[model samples]
Target: YKAFEPQEARRILDKLEIHYTPKHGSWLNMAEIELSILSRQCLDRRIPNQEVLKNEVAAWQDKRNSISKPMEWQFTNQDARVKLKKLYPTIQQ
Candidate 1:
């Protein structure tokens, strides 16, 4: 995957009309975090089959939805500029 050329990937995406995040962007981080939480809370144990897994995940989702609140994201662009400075390229003026 790492060996794949960015230009080739971009060409494919352009052909497919797919939008993408910039390199090193945390666009998928929140969903990844949620999956981690779900794994810890409900999926850590081995389930015998897909049906059991589905039921367990559904129950977990119901319980989570019942108690869920909107997330207040605190990381601003300025915060990202400071914390993830290396991830961004310097602008030429």
Candidate 2:
């Protein structure tokens, strides 16, 4: 598909006022880890169809929810400011 023109993209972004994290950032890394775990633990076998896939995922979710534990996210904004400082724009004092 053709990409959006720069002006159009900028206009949309301005309208949405969306906040986005950088690629390979901690949030994205955590999401990738979750998806990898789901794929390995719940979707290791071939799913014959979308219906089967949906049912399988639902069952997996039910089982997971029953035994779910809170995730401990260690990364903090302060940590990001220190470790990923290069990715952020400089602040003027």
Model 1, runs deviating above 4 Å:
1-27, 87-93
Over 4 Å off, model 2: 1-33, 87-93
What shift in Å separates residue 91 of candidate 2 from its native position after superposition? Answer: 7.4
Question: Which candidate's TM-score is highest?
Answer: 1
TM-score against native, each model: 0.57, 0.50
What digit string (tens of lDDT, one per residue) describes model 2 on residues 22-75? 554577776687789799998998889999999999988888789877557688
Candidate lDDT (C-alpha), each: 0.82, 0.81
Tens digits of lDDT, candidate 1, 1-93 = 265699887776677855565354475885677799899999999899999999999999999889886455778899989999999899999
After superposing all C-alphas onto the true structure, candidate 2 shows an RMSD in angstroms of: 9.3
